[model samples]
Target: MKFLVLCLIALIHQSASQSPQASCQFENSIDYTCVLTLTNPNGLNNITEIEVNHMPNRTNDDVVIVRTSIFSTSRNIPSIICDTFRNLRSIDMFRTGLTKIDEDSVSNCKLLELMTVRFNQIADIHPNAFAENAELRTVQLDANNLTSVPENLFENNKKLVEINLSQNGLAVLPKKLLSGLSELRGLFLTHNQISEIYEDTFADATNITSLGLGNNSLTYLPDKIFSSLYNLLDVYLQNNQLMKFNPYWFQNAKSLRALYLSNNGITYFPEDSFVNFYKLRELMLDRNPIQKLPGKIFASLGELTWLDLENCQLVYLDPSLFLSTYNLWMLKLANNDIYELPGGVFGSLKYLATLDMTNNQLQAISSTSFYFHPDLRTVRFGQNQINAVDEKFLDVVNVTQLNMEQNVCADGFWNDDSETKELFRTELRVCFENYIEPPQYCPIGNEYERICELEAQTASLTLENAGIRRDLEGLAARIEQLERLISSSP
Candidate 1:
């Protein structure tokens, strides 16, 4: 009798652990894969919420998820549903008129990994909305009306990696707002009204790799705000009202790859400002009022590739400005007041491929100015005072396009050698005539070895002319002395 009781106990335990197979219908839609779904039951009760008792046993239950479309019209997600969908992985909702999430709504969703409630009118959330949902990894609440979030809302969720709360009315981030998410890799808060961020807002989020604060009203960021994020990769601070860049802002973020600070009122960048970003690659500072960049500002960013300083109202650039940016590929300096490019300005950018200096006040460029860049392919010097071109400018053997149109030159400057002009594919139109004396329109050497030989000849002639002028001045002084002596003697 004792043995028979043991067998009966074993059978009951197996039955409790295994759930019955749930019936499902295939939706056959392109965007969604068919999964275990719950349809509204027909009856007077109407089943306002799903309870733990309504689900099958844990062992037999398949992964359950609430489709985004169905949740769009759903009113709420009760705390009881967490018990029913114990094996659930995701819960998506949108446009459901969800105004608030009460406490413990999804506290015990042990297997929950992803949740999205975007494009809704949700304005509030209980502190325990996801209190103990440890397995939750991604939460996307973009396009909501949320003004504030619980400071400890994600305190119990250590596995949370990404949180996107963009397009909201958040004006400020409270300190410790994202305190417990230690594994977070991405935090996007773009297109908001955020004017300030607390110093300790990201105190515990050390693993964040990408942070977006663009399209906001931020005028300044507190010092050491991102001092702990060592693995940070990308930062977007565009479309803000920042007046300056603090040198200590990215002191600890050395693994940064891309930085965007475009469309701001930044007038200057401190020297050695990017000394900590050793592995940075892409930097965009376009559309700022920066008149100049400090020398050695990009000294430590040796791994940089793309740099955009377009429309920054720059009047001049240091000759060694790009001395450390040897690996730079694409550089855009279009729409500035750069009157001239000194020799060897781009000597350090050996890998530079595309250079855009269009719409500037460049009057002349030396023949050996681009000598270091052997891999250069395209160059744009249009709409300037450039009246002459040398064969050395086309030294890059693989150069495909050279835009020199709309400048001071004769219309038939390159017409004498139509073959080489066709081979180079340059826009050598005569937009203006040279007004200077002697009209230095000569380009030394042929297309193969375009050296400025006339420059040397001009230098020799200038020295001879200077000697004659000195002799004439000396002779005039002696004649004046003789005239004075003659008058005094009389």
Candidate 2:
């Protein structure tokens, strides 16, 4: 009778521990055979880690879970499996086979800060996976196969900083999924299948510096997609299906220095596509179907130093293409159908160090091609139509390899701008009393009210003067002063 009474006690405990109503759906329905029987090894008060099947019968809400470590080498954790622990700090069940996450269990792990469950079988996580977990700042799921992310994913965890969901199977990123994580800085969504994002997806990430969205199916982007990433410095948009480019796509990316847009379907970007990206340092545009490059293609890419334009059908370009790119250091225009190159095409590159024109149809080069370079290091005019060679050619400052293997031209033409461009620098700096930055064509930079104010003042003053716009002397004078001030600024 004593033995029978003990068995009855065990049966009662097991039933109470295992009878939670299933709210989250699983991939398959399987009968649970887990019977919990927990015994604190160092007494009932000092234990740390416990097996999921050994959750002793208890109703206390203050069980301080130090380490809820799984026993097996496998790392997948069940959604509602840690029902025994109350105040867990860190859970490391990564690479496990977790399927569904019980949203209610989030309140149990109130102090959880770090969670690792990558390479798991979790295809769907509850939208409120971190609803009540306020202290969870880092969550890593680098190799998961999640297909969709739902809204309210981090609705209330306003302190989250780093989230790594890269190398996943995502298709479309949900709206406002990161709505409450306003303090997050670093986000890595590389190597996924994400294709859609509303304009406000990055609305709250004002402090984000680096964002990687490479290797995806993104075909289009809104004008204000990076508006909230004001402090962004590095951005990767490679390996996508972008058909066209827009100048306003990066309106607020004022601080971006490095941009990668290689391996896309862009045929020919507008010459002004990068006009606003003034401080850009490196640009990578390899392996695209770019057929026509505008004469003033690199007009405003003033800060570009390293440029890669390989694997494209670049045939014709204006001799004054690199006029504004005066600080270029390395240029790679190889692997294309480049039939002609003006002798002085790279004339403005005062700091040019290396030039790689390999596998191109280069015919000839003249002394004026690279006239004023004091630091040129290497030149590759190889694999082209080379026949005639000037005795005075290859006498550059520091050119190492004079690759005249395949080129047939008497001498490349030099349409050099003999007029010194730096002479106008002094004329624009003349003293003006009320000098201001000139109004630009950008909607935000130049408002309609400013135009109205100038028009009204000019009309009133010109009534006593003459009809010519120049006769509206004060108005024209102010605009000229503002233009000069804007031009002289850094």
Candidate 3:
């Protein structure tokens, strides 16, 4: 029989020359992606996949990449590209341990777009797995250990845009959990242990725009909970134990722009809290124990520019408070318990630059305190109890780094007085003339030389008492001219 047809052509050329394995390549045989890099026992333990049904440049819309080399060991995520690449588009299983993912595990890949089980340990995921994937857009179950998420898991991925369950342990988020992901745009539940977040929780992810609930344990947030995210932009509630923050849940976040409530135990804040954030520009209420605030609370953020009230133990500040932050530039009231700053507080900040009242209890600062519009720069009154510095304080703007460290100067004041040390040396460079204490020393060894020896003996006793009154007026004018010439001596 022709030697059994040459022994079946030598067994199909030894199964197409031992099926691609020199660190398999051909990354794209014209959209038919292929990249099987397995090497550690060559194709690790005699290959667990890549049947490629007699590969001779496989095609059926081929897309296969079974990478495994980093001293490979944790394998089992290969359903052989869902049973030999039936037009599969993507499947990247990196650092595998994919503990669970049933429902035919990506059966009929249906042109899968991208499914990355990143740095895995993936804990169960069978709600029809990907419910027969409808061209999934992107799903990277980041650093997984996922707790629960089977409510129609991704409800038939509506062209799902992005989903990275960041460092998961997710506690609760199962109400229509991202219902029909309406084109979700970046939703990463940062380091979750999520504590309450319902109001139909993002009701179908209304075009979420960057929401990473930072280190979650969130305390409360359910009123209109982001009012359907109206194209929301930037929301990362840092750390978290959120105490209160319901400004009617952003009254329809008018395109919110950068808002990260740092740390958190947030002590209330609803004086029209950012009135629809009118395109807010960087606002992070630092730390938070927020002591008080209601003077038209930021007067409607008119495009506020970077304002992080550091520490927030704010004492007083309502002189038309921040007068609509007129383009404020970098203002962080560092570690506050602020004592006083009321008169037109920062008088409409007209482009004010870097003013961090470092560690406060400020005693005085009013020469129309920071008035008029003039791009002033860097003024951090370090650790304050400021004992007087109003020699026309900041004389109408133009400062260049003045930190007034740990103040309390008053005798011969601020540098042995050269007219109050040239009034803070023409707007500052006084570079730390130390003193948080030591100043009441009055043993007068030299009080400016005893005040210049009492003003030079009172000006030499006023010229010796005017020469004894001009010698008694010249002896009464020669005794009245000898008594009028001896009474006319006739």
Q: How close is candidate 3 to the true structure, as a TM-score?
A: 0.31
Candidate 3 all-Cα RMSD: 22.4
Greater-lDDT candidate between 1 and 2: 1
Count clashing residue pairs in model 3. 0
- The clash tally of candidate 2 reads 12
Best by lDDT: 1
What is the C-alpha lDDT profile of model 1 across 196-267, one tens digit per residue?
997778888999999999999999999989888888899999999999999788888888999999999999
Q: TM-score rank, highest first?
A: 1, 2, 3
Backbone N/Cα/C clashes per model: 2, 12, 0
Runs in model 3 with CA error above 4 Å? Answer: 1-127, 130-151, 154-175, 178-199, 202-223, 226-234, 237-246, 250-258, 261-270, 274-366, 370-377, 380-490
- Per-prediction TM-score: 0.74, 0.64, 0.31
For model 3, the run of ten residues with the poorest summed lDDT:
434-443
lDDT of each: 0.69, 0.61, 0.67
Candidate 3: C-alpha lDDT = 0.67
TM-score comparison, 1 vs 3, better candidate:
1
Higher-scoring candidate on lDDT, 1 or 3: 1
Which candidate model has the greater TM-score, 2 or 3? 2
